[model samples]
Target: MGNINKRGSKDLVVDSDQSQQDSPTITVDNQLCDAIIKEDCSTIKALLRSHPVNQPLTILTSYRLLFEQQTCTVIPIHLAAEYCKPRSLLCLLEHGADPEVRDTQGHTTLHLMLLHWPIVSSTWTKPGNRIQRLMADIQNNAVSCLHILFQHGAQVNAQVGNSNKYSPLHLAITYGTHPILSLLAQNGAQVNAVNESSMTPLHMAADILNENMIKTLIACGANVNCVIPHNGNTALKLAVCTASSKAGQLLSAGVGCIRLLLIHGAHVNAQDHEGQTALHEACCGGREAIINLLLEFEANVNILTKNGESAIYMYLQRSSNIRDLMVLTRLLYCSYPLRLTNRQGVLPAGIMLPEFQLLKETLVRLARKPLPLEDICKKNIRNIYGKKYKYYVRQLLPGKLWNSIYNCYDLADVLKGDL
Candidate 1:
């Protein structure tokens, strides 16, 4: 009986010590919590100096003492954010709390701030809801917190482990926080890093159509042609597939990037897993300027994909841009014995319904245009100036314009069949 009592006493002392150690340092939690709740600085400073490495799990528990008992282990920054104390939050971050520390639910300080600040601010009814405060925090010291995490080797490339796997850089871009993205990139974030869906920062930039971000990424040497691992879609491919403003910006940037890729020896004939080339993308985008440029680089006009669709077919099917239509016609007529069959074994002309019959007929007229007198000329001099000049004139001026000189008639009236 005496031995058992002694053993029980020792066990009780061990439990007590464990309890004391498990408790957050009371003085530190009280002082910091007071600062955070009251927006006090001196108390926060004294508390920081005393226990510079103190954590906030206890004061948060005290808040549960104030409210009902709920699991509350958020850090001081998160608490500051909760109380709408931006200045105090900044102080805590400056003092050495880990911003990237995950809560029990795995939310970081930024995530907490992003999630809760607006809610707390919204309860005030009508003073503008602390938007400027939150934006300022995010723009200034919060970005520094993000940078600090990066400096200490945090992963900007980390996805949220959801289906989307959006990285920090992806979030910054999505939120239009340009400064954060720039900081992340400067801190060695992968500009072209992909998410679980195999979408790179370039893909996000293109999807969002942030022209400045896109240009910045391109300038930073993002692989413009980096294909998504899952679908084999390039940044250019994704850009063209959308009807959003981003598509316009990418098309406006034109073949400069595309030309850069091609000049650097990007496979002009490289097909997506779907078997579409950059030319096909440009045509489908109805970007006349880019289509012209791609053709100049000799992008495969008749290159069939696994589905057997040619660039011309995609242009006719997806676009109403007159320039794309003209360029497609030129590509088809200029090719050697052009075939109209797409990847699906559907001829572009035969597949035409009422929507595209006019276009199809127009293309047929262009394809059936007569060869020039120069091709028939035997002499070198005639050959130089004859058929070539005829082709040039026909290409440069419409049939009506040429007929005004040839038939001595009113070009507009005659072309409209009025005469």
Candidate 2:
């Protein structure tokens, strides 16, 4: 059998039966590649001028010369951008290289620039200063390179990469090209452009938990409530589900991202395709802080997903250990409706492990009891004053008194019985 490779519109074949020595080799002009790497404009110009017009040579030609064995076709401008060679990039554009030319993977020069940006180590030490200087220079050059491409009529909103259909802004946010994100926005990149998955760049930012990028997109007028079309996931829902950590290890920035989105008017109770809200996602995460934050923002604990699963049901079903029992207790404290059943008709209590019998009994007892008069007053105040004022009310009340009113009882004593 012969091995087939696709390059641009052409297909090259290699015989698998051929020995390594018997295979034909393709050679590229090393000097042209060297001139590009060194950013030698004069040499590049000379080389281009010397090549016959009939040959139709280009920067892509130079790239092919160096990497003939590469199955993926990349253009010279792509290389310049990847290497942060601003001078070479500008020179190529001046010489009529297409800034919008996509590689085999459908990444334009702009996509490559941000996607392959140099990684800078955070460790501060003796060699760090020099590395930091180099990073700064590369970043500045990358910014300049982006500006040049934009000025030369690059498509600011063109979707890149074959599978992802990511707009340049999406790439910028995904790759941490912070400065380029703002520049792209200012240069008329579509802030709310959806990828192949119908996810906007804001969704991507939320998934990565980049609060600054989220702010940048929101300031640029990216819709905070923009929902993925297929699944109907808003940025807030994504933030809750895709948060980079689990439970106690939850990233503060991720929580802050969710809070920021909510403040900016991301729909807290916005449901996905499955009718699950951000609160449902937080329960699945089993993170008390996120669950608390969502509840504070008025996320409905009793809202049922398409499967008829409430946030409390999700918490009990997904929670792995006693540590998460406190999260369940907190949900109970919030007065999550206890009588609700899932699509399977199983109540939250029905899913309890034998180990959680005490916790389950406690929850059932609390559910049957009426709210104390003080708690009713506080709940009314909380509802009237809104989520932000609840904190102030807590501060004004004595610690013991407030805990009692909100049913903020500790679960440690129950857990200690098992210990």
lDDT of each: 0.54, 0.68
The C-alpha TM-scores of every prediction are: 0.59, 0.77
The top-ranked prediction according to TM-score is: 2
In model 1, where is the ten-residue run with the lowest total lDDT?
Answer: 1-10
Would you give me the overall lDDT of model 2? 0.68
Q: List the residue pairs that clash in candidate 2.
A: 28-65
Per-residue alpha-carbon lDDT of model 2 for 318-345, expressed as tens digits?
Answer: 5363355566655654543354457886
Instruction: List the pairs of residues colliding in candidate 1.
Output: 307-343, 308-342, 308-343, 309-343, 374-387
